[model samples]
Every structure is written in C-alpha cells, then in structure tokens.
Target: MRDWFVASRVSAGFIVVLVGYTSSAVIVFQAAAAAGASEQQISSWLWALGVGMGLSSIGLSWYSKKPILTAWSTPGAALLVTSLQGLSINEAIGAFLFSSLLITLSGLSGFIDKLIRWIPQSLASAMLAGVLLQFSLQLFSALESQLILVVAMIACYLIGRHIAPRYVMLLTLLVGCGVAYQLGLLDLSSVSFQLAKPEWVSPDFSWQALIGVGLPLFVVTMASQNMPGIAALHGNGYRPAISPIIAWTGVTGLVLAPFGGFAFNLSAITASICMGKEADSDPSKRYLASIWAGIFYIAIGLLGATVVSLFAAFPQELVTAVAGLALLSTIANSLAGALADAEGREAAICTFLLTASSVSFFGIGSAFWGLSLGMLVHYFTQAVSKKKQLMKT
Candidate 1:
C-alpha cells in the first residue's frame, strides 16, 4: 500500500477531491441553508458528505481494481436548494433516507446496470463528452479574468505534456498557485482548522416529503448523476460493474443521510481526474490515486469546516484552469468515440448537443434528456432504414 503512495498519484487524488469540493460544496451549503440547518448542523452535512464519499470511493476502487470515485449528488443538492424549502430538517432527513432506499433497490435489482449496458458506446461517449464540454471551456474562460495565471497554467500543461505527460496536472497546479500568489489572488488568512461533529436528525417521514423531495432526488441522482458517471468510466476504458458501485453509494447514503449526507453516487467529472493519465501513466496503478482521494475526503470530513475554508481560499480561476486542463484528454477521447460510429453518428451528435445545453425539466437534468433522446433517435433511425430495405426487397 505504501509502495504506490507516490507524489504524482497523491497530487492526482488531491486534485480530484479539490475539484469535487470546489465545484459543488457551495451548492451543498446552500441546500443545508434551505433546510434551515443551524451552524453545527451544516458542519454535520459536510462531515457526512466527506466521510461517505471517502469510504465508498476507497472501498470500491480497492475492491474493484478501478479508480472508482463517488460524490455527493450535485443535482440533488441543486434540487434541495429549492425543494428543501418549507420542509423541516427532520423531514428532509426522511426524504434523504427514502431516496437512498430507492437507489439501493434500483441497484440491488440490477436495473441500473442492465439499463447502462443497453446504451450504445457511441451515445455513452457523446453524453460524457457533453458533460465535460463546459469544464474544458471554462479553462479558457478563466483567461478573461486572470490572463497571466491561466496562460501560465496552459503553458505549463503544454510543456509538461511534451516532456513529462504524467505530471502535467501536478506541475500545472503548482504553476497556477505560483502565478496566483504572485498576483496576490489567494486569501488564506481567515482559514482555520476546526473538526466537525456529526449530529443525526431523527427522521420524520411524511408522504409529502417523499413525493416531493425524496422521489425527485432519486430520479435526478440516477438519471443525471449516475448515468453520466458510468458513461465517464466507460469512456475512460474502466468498466467496473455498475450495480455494486451504485449499491455501495446508496448504502453509504442510507447510513449517513441523517447526519446530512443527502445523496451519494458515482462521480463523473472529478473521477475522471483520478482515472486520467495525469494520475499515472499506467492505468492499473490509477486506483492508488482514488485511494489517496478517499484519504483526503476522510480528512475533510473529520476536519469539516476547517478544510472547506482552505479550499475556498483558492481563486476561482485557478480551480477552473486546473479542472479544465485535467480533463482535456478525457473530452478529446470521448469526442473521438462519439464520432467513431457512423451508424450512430446522428444520434450521438444530438445527444452531445442536448446534454451540452445543460437543460433541465421536472427536476431531471440534461444528461438524462440527452441519453433518452439519443437512444430514441438511434433506434428510430435504425428501424426506418430497416423498413426501407424491406420495401426494396
């Protein structure tokens, strides 16, 4: 275990947790606020999420021999920001329990795996591509605000790619920090290390909360979060069985939800960082990165608000640039896969466009819409062509 604890992999793991927290930890905070959670309760939320994600990610990656990363449901957090309103914290906990139960059943029944197995690789790749398009684009968008910082990061990535491809992300991260410090962009003076204590809210089950919050959270977490997450793993050529992974996250959520772990699912975007070549040149060794990520996550949970302040101190552009750089190869590979299949070309393109739009309806996200539409279009076009062939015959 200690043999593989190299700096490059450790950095990769840190980047994964860093990206995950920076990207959606704020949303989690807002969701807690929506539920009218007090200060201590909010800290509990962070503790639950961090600990839950860490345990599942490490367990799955080690057992499965895949760089499997788990995350709090960002979409579910977004939904809670609105739907958690007017519901007591106890009811919200009940809703979290109910939703996690649904996810567990879905995984145990093998439905999620079968459904994912049914998706065409082309469309799956398209969905993954669409999901990452924004992050890749954000890299350059950061340039407008911090031209030198972003440029230095980009240059570091380019140079590192040529000479030391495996360490590009780490080197880029260092350069981004250096540039940011030179510009006085970081503010860490207010950061403090305070361990978070978990407080379990006894659940108050209500049909109203179940139907309103529980059900919708289940739907988005599955369709938007889990689906894309599986797609990401598949895109990157890591095919860990989907059912057990989902089951693990659902089970973890069930255990920790009362302490404010709303939902946990397979992570797509941040997981990609751990699975990338930047984590390690050898794919099999990448699991070490995820294990390292799990360690970081556990530290965050244990330290709770203490670490969040540290994470928040970094400039937004630095985060954006690193995330974007880390994911470039993944985006490119997914695009290649999406376009590789001539038979599914039209469907793949449609899926890509729809998912990249980031549209949502009825609390479901664009990934679901794109996947559903892509599958429909792919099958419809095939049927039409077959009918035409029959007519000719």
Candidate 2:
C-alpha cells in the first residue's frame, strides 16, 4: 500500500485534478447560468458532476486495474452555454437524460466501438486538435491583455519542462498565482468556505431540446471527447473494454442529470497525466494515481461551492493562460498524430481545418462536420485512385 501511495504518484494525481478544475470549471458554471439555474442549482451541478466523476474514476480504475479516469464533458458544457437558449433547466435535464440514454444504447449494442474503429486515427486526432485549437489561441489572446501573467506562466512552464517535466503545470500554476498577486490581480473577497448541497429538479421534456441539445450533446461527447480518450488510452499502451466503460458513464450521467450533471465521458487530456510515465515508472501502479485523483474529486464535490469561489478568485487571464499552457503538450501530441499518416494527410488536413474554423451547420458543431467531411474525402480519393489504376491496366 505504501509503495503504491508514493509521493510522486499522489502529486501527479493531484495535478490532474487541479488542471481539470481550473481549465473548464468556469465553462460549467456558465452552462448552468445559461440554463437559468439558481445559485443553489449551480452548486448542485458542481456537486453532482464532481461526485459522478469521482465514483466513475475510482470504481472503474479499481475494477479494470487500469488508469480509467472520467470527466464532465467540457465541450458539452460549451455547447450548453450556446444551445440552452430558450430552454429551462428542466428541459436541459431532459436533454441530458436523452443524450445519456443514447450513449448507453450505443454501448450496449456494441456499435460505439465499431463506429470509432471506422474513424481513421488521423481524423480522430485531427478533430481533437481542432477542438483544442481555440484554447491555444486564447493563450496568446490572454498575453495580449495580461502580458505579465501569461509571460510568467510561460517562463515557469519552460523551466519546469527542462528541469522536471512531470510538474510543469504545477510549477506554472504557482508562478502564475505569485505573479497575479504581485500585479494586484488576485481577488479573494468573493471566496468563501461553504459546502455544496445538491438540489433536485424534476425534468420537463421538450422535443425541441431533445432534438437540439440532446442529439448534439451526444454527438460531440462521442466524436470529440470519448474518441480521443480511447486514443489516449491506446496510445499509452492501456486497453480496457471500451463499451462497458462508456455505458457505465452514460448510466451514471442518466442518474445524475436531474441534479445538474450535464454530460459524463472518458477524459483524454487529464487522463494522459495519470497514465503517463510521470505518474509511475511501473504501468501497473498507475491505477493508484487515478485512485488518488478520485479521492480529490470527492473532496471537491463535498466542497463544491467553496471550490467554485476559490477558482473564481483567480483572474481570468491567469486561468486562461494556465489552461492553455497545461494543454500545450497535449495539443502538440495531437497535431503530430493527426498528420502522421502519409496516405491520410489530405483527409486529415481537411478535418483539422474544418474543425478549427468553428463553423456550425444546422445547429451541429464543426467537429462532427469535420470528421464527416474528412471521411467522405478519404473515400472519394480512394475510389478515384483505384479507378485510375484499373484504367491503366
């Protein structure tokens, strides 16, 4: 037990939790607000999401003996922020339930993995790169506004990368906070110490929300989030049964939707932290890192309101810069994978460009369109090549 609970593993796990909260918790808050949730309901949203993630991460990691981490779908939250217009909280709950049900059905039918397999690796990586490209741009945008804070964080990240790559996010966070403090950017007055309490609301189903929010939510979570998460697990030499894991997340989301859990899915970016060599030299011990991460998630859920306030205290620029810097390595790795295949280069570039464009058609996001179009291009090119070869013969 002591061997598994070593300091480095604990720290790595803690860093994953920290980055998860800091990077996208605000988007969750905004989504709740857009749904017209009361402050109490927002707190409940945090509590539900935190608890759901905690249980899923710990339970799955223990059962599989792998670093199986779960996260609230950040892209889903962003979608909710935009798509919840004219929708009540109850209607949103209905959408969440609908999306979860679809996900569960897909897994049970064994269709989800088959669909994912149909997607070329380059396209999947391209979609991930496109989804994350906005954050990369925001890093520089924040620099333009808060030069010192961003510059300090970048310097710390570079130094940490050179000396101790495992803790680059932690080091950047510490240095960013220090710089924010010195520059009078830290504001703790809004911070408080209060535990979050869950509030339940009965769901009111609407066909509009079901078609608009539910369908898109499921698509983005599956195409943009879960696909990359599986890739991360595979890329890192870990393979667990994908269907059951996804089905379990869907079930958990279904149970918690009424309490403000919007979407639940496997984590790609943060899971990489716990699954990587920095977590442990021995692959077998990495599950312990996920276990520690689960423990921290429970604490965050219990203190959801307080954690929200604490994150709120940090300046926007600080948070933006930190999130961007934390994801820099992930973005680079994804870009490399997206462009890795010589044969798929044209299709992959098409996916990346369309996704990064952030264009929406018929209420669906670009990530979905990018993959769809890329696949079409792939097949079309292949057909043309084959026909030309046959003509030569």
TM-score of each: 0.98, 0.85
lDDT of 2 at 283: 85
Candidate 1, 47-80: lDDT as tens digits: 9999999999999998988999999999999999
For candidate 2, the 10 contiguous residues with the lowest summed lDDT are 322-331
> What stretches of model 2 exceed 4 Å from their correct place?
1-27, 30-36, 78-92, 204-216, 231-239, 269-289
- Which residue pairs come into collision in candidate 2? none
List the global CA lDDT of all models. 0.92, 0.84
- Candidate 2 matches the true fold with a TM-score of 0.85
The per-candidate count of clashes, in order, stands at: 0, 0
Best by TM-score: 1
lDDT of 2 by residue, 1-393 (tens): 677667657776776777789788989999999999998999999899999999999999999999999999988998999999889999999999999999888878888767767777777777767766787689899988899889988888788777876556667777888999999988999888988899998998999999999999998898767876886676566778799999999999999999998899998778877776556668898898898888888889989979767877888888777667756765677778888888889998998899889897755567778888889988898999999999999
Q: Which pairs of residues collide in model 1?
A: none
